[model samples]
Target chain A: MTTETHLVVAVLTVVAVAVIVRMVRRGVLKAKYTVLWLTVGLVLAVAASVPTLLDTVADRLGIWYQPTLFLMLAIGFLLLVAMHFSYELSRLEKRVRALAEELALLRGPVPDDTADGGATGDGSG
Target chain B: MRTAVIIPAFDEADALPAVLAELAAHVPDHEVVVVDDGSTDGTHRVAAAAGATCLRLPFNLGIGGALRLGFRYAATQGFDRAYQFDADGQHDASQIPALLAGLDDADMVVGSRFSDDRGYRVGRSRGLAMALLRLLVRRVTGRRFTDTSSGFRAFRRPVLEFFATEYPMEYMESVEALVLAVRSGFTVREVPVVMHDRAAGTASNRNLRLAYHFVRLLIVLLAGGRATGHTPQVAR
Candidate 1:
């Protein structure tokens, strides 16, 4: 119930809400990415409210202080961004290939009158 | 034959009314569809007032994306031919007849400024750049085009379908369409035509930026393939 603890809780609450809103807007919040961001946001919010949990994790990971915990958070955000970019790149390649196939068909040929007649059973072939 | 001219406009409200007027005067029978490529300016209103069917994109999709939408409309709406005309008044709409005339023999008839020994208004450096592009395109596709970069061209039904599917979003390297058509055994004829300087905005790709594009396009074409022979066309 200290003044600094109250400020940390307010800031983390605001960040968790902002990240949730962004995820919702991008439509990635519905699936695995959403769950991951939500978990991180929730954990950070709880750690702000109860600072002892931070010291317990720090002790378990053999970290001397909470600054090392901050580094883990930064790495998690970078991993998420990299994963999103790769997904977008794969989607673009599939789109390009589909387009190329359409072009191949349209530019194929005008069916010949002879083939049309033969296929229709006129038997000129 | 019913034809629709799709003029893709991007912040060219100043020059569009004049171009629409010229199109109406020379080719009154053809319908004009102007796709405003997400212009912040009042391009849609101006185009509609000037008597063109206006389709506004939600955002700027560049020239190729706009043209693909236009072509799809032309195909589904039952237009016999679809022609792409620029909004800056650089292309001469009077040459519409020649493009239509060559349509029977070719799937697409491109307006080439260098076709019949015609001169260019572009400077010496730009002129040389175009010459090198023609040579590079020739080497890659085994075909030479006078104005590989000209936006003034007409497409028959099949070419219309071809572009709707796989149109390049970038500007530099769309000659893939022409190369793909030839590979699929479609005939592409280059017709001689005059291109005027922009009446209102500047060229989309100008000067050093333009030169860089040709070099980049050349690399793509060379890397794709140089093995060229006749792709036999099925007789219709």
Candidate 2:
């Protein structure tokens, strides 16, 4: 790898780590999710700083280009994150639907369904 | 046994009044609950004025979500049976008794427009879509449903409770709900009823929407019914 390429990767990894830390501090991102981002950033930094490590791994895997190995790893990491988010989203959707049902019930009866000639002032309008 | 009529209405202020009036006149003994699906107009007020219970959703959850809310209300309120009626005035209130009567031998009763030699006109595209859905449902459930998309239906307590907890929140929920009901070991029967066109406003099903709905419903049914562990409770 060129010295300039190494420098770029190092700077990008540092920036990502800084951003994740800021998000965690601001409570925009939870600590649990931040761990995943931090690990990803640290792995990128390690691979970029030690190009020989990437080269050996790529050679063992019969890859002609070492950079392609790094690209593949980054893609794999992103795919994992996306799948995790999908599962979280599915859970959150179910919770939201359940909450909505509860809220509707709490809002009280529609006038005709009630027994006492319709409760006049429940603010259901 | 107590019964609740669940009407899920979205922006149907013009049409809802008459439907509610018909319910009040014909089915006064039953409880009428209109789920106002976050209409921008006076749907909630109209339903209230017509002496129907109005459950106002904060936003539009579409027909499926609104009906689920209605089901939840019915189940929680200790209703023995629940009927799904349309706010667009397409479903005849007078036929509700027949639907409930048809429920005597089944867990769920569907008011089918194509049953009992009842002639209801359908557009070419919609007729074709209904035919395809009928074929798919028959293939999967080993039962023939002449009108799989009919919104007018009645459900006994167990089926109502099941749908209250889990229902398809998508475009063609009626079709999907049928699949779910039959797959979950609930018997569904169809009774012929005369259905009229919307008294006011337009239906949401246009050419493009119908095409999209057909593809989506086909995918959902083909993917198999939703995995709801709803064991049928003993009927009351």
Candidate 3:
């Protein structure tokens, strides 16, 4: 609840929100992803402004230190963001595989008379 | 049915010419596709010079990715069967007929090296890994497979289409693909085939990498589910 700590938190929150908004406006960050970052920034700002709210929540959770609570929440938020990135990575990997398959097939030879003959047979020699 | 031989090559410039030659001599009737998996050598040129239809990937996509592309080509080009062969010259092209013969009753036919004691021996580590995979696949599919990691195999049209849509892009895709096939209601069989040591180029799996790959593949096979939803084609 020190004045200096409050000033630092306020500045950091403002910078985070401004950067996120600028990225969103430049289309570098999609709206869906921006929402998560925006929420994190807003929560930090609110927690920093209402210093007593942090102490009350920490007391209810049986934590002696209020900063630890903030630290735990920040860590949990980061873990969720990391999990979301992993899901996005998995999806992109699948799409890349599909695209690679399509590109290779496009580069292959056209089906011809021999291909037709091969298709009609019993495929047993 | 029309059959195409899909050879997935990665930096096999030294061995591709002879492999293509043997394939041309042994199975000239079948369409041959050499998918050059972003080799930094003359692999594409060698395949093209040998008269095999060569598809060069812009970058390396490993064996699984290359084979998936082959399946896509087979399915889209209306091939009735697609045969997977290795460009390392380890797979015998002459055994392709036996694979095709097995296709008469099965949706997928694997050219197994251990089915009839063809005398193909692996190192202790690889043997143990293969044994574990065989047991896992047998338990999952209720059918025993002697060579679950064999790259040489043949697939019917429906199986080709299924794999073209979805396949494992992992270290042990060969074994995983078989599990996928069996789980998707496709009949799978194995035929004995002789294999040779690589004519050239070092194996992608070796030493520390092999150990890591074995662990990773074990986890993936144990945790993964069926990869496709296509119903098996009725027996011809």
Candidate 4:
């Protein structure tokens, strides 16, 4: 990582952290999501500040290309996050569907009294 | 026994009037409960005008979701039995007695179109899909169901109560609900019944979406096991 690029990454991560903190104070983001984004920001800041950190880790993994490790990690993280999002979306949809059903049932009326006479006779009619 | 006809209508104002009229004529004693699934067309108004109980949803939930709502209402209203009647004029009101009579021996009765030559003709591809679904349903439930996708069905009180909450809220839910009822130790039987194509209002045709839902149903049947366990009364 070049020093200039590292400086940019670090600055951007700091700005992101500041924004996240502000959102937290304003209660804009849910705690779970705020924690998720803050953890991501923290990891990016650490990686930017320590240029050799990634390289050392890459060497231990026996990868000739150090950036490959970073790319792999980023891709894996993103895939997992995307899967989590889909799971959350499915759950939310199910809840909304249940709520819709409940609403309809609440508004649903009692069947008319015409069945009163029929209940007495054989339903063959 | 109080029998409720649960009609799940979605923008079927054009078709519902005739269907409800036929129902009232054939089974005057059976009260009808129509669940309007967020229709832009005043489906709710037609249902209410029919002198039937109507429940209007705030937004569109698919057929399965709408049916679940209808079942929930029927069960809560102390209905002893309930049968699903199509709002699109596809189900035969004259067949209601036959369909409901099956309930005497079984907890759930499916009005099968293919059991007799009476199953209205479908395109070749749809026929093939129907066959595959029947095979899979047979495998899943270890019981052969000639018409796995038939929406015309009747359920005894226990089945209605069970389905009030646990009914599958997805496309091809009829098959899932069939397997669910069987797995829950409820007796399910199929009766030969004639069905007609929609007399009015067009089917919301989407080949691609139907294909996707078919694949999803396959995966759920194979992996999730339509039984999803005997957990009682949990709405999904």
| Predicted structure with the largest DockQ when compared to the true one | 2
Give the per-residue lDDT digits (tens) of candidate 2, residues B117-217: 76788878778888999999998889998999899899999998889867788777888899889988998999989898653327875668778878988
Query: What does candidate 1 score on TM?
Result: 0.66
Candidate 1 chain A worst ten-residue window by lDDT? A116-125
DockQ of each: 0.03, 0.36, 0.23, 0.29
Give the total clashing residue pairs for model 1.
0
For residues B90-161, write the lDDT of model 1, one tens digit per residue.
Answer: 888888888778898888888887788655477678678778777877876788787777778888987787
Model 3 chain B: weakest 10-residue lDDT segment is B227-236
Off by over 4 Å in 2: A110-125, B198-201, B206-210, B225-236
Q: Docking quality tier of candidate 4?
A: acceptable
Backbone clash pairs for candidate 4 read: none
Model 2, residue B56: C-alpha shift (Å):
1.5
Report the candidate with higher lDDT, 1 versus 2.
Answer: 2
Q: Clashes in model 2: which pairs?
A: A110-B53, A110-B54, A111-B53
Which residue ranges in model 4 land beyond 4 Å of their true spot? A2-8, A110-125, B199-201, B227-236
The 10 consecutive residues of candidate 3 chain A with the worst lDDT sum are A116-125
lDDT, candidate 3, at B64:
80
Q: After the best TM-score superposition of candidate 2, give how far the Cα of residue B191 lies from its true spot, in angstroms.
A: 0.8
Candidate 2 has a DockQ of 0.36
lDDT of 4 at A27: 98
CA error at residue B97 for candidate 1, angstroms? 1.0
TM-score of the second chain for every model: 0.89, 0.93, 0.92, 0.93
At residue A62, candidate 3 shows an lDDT of 94
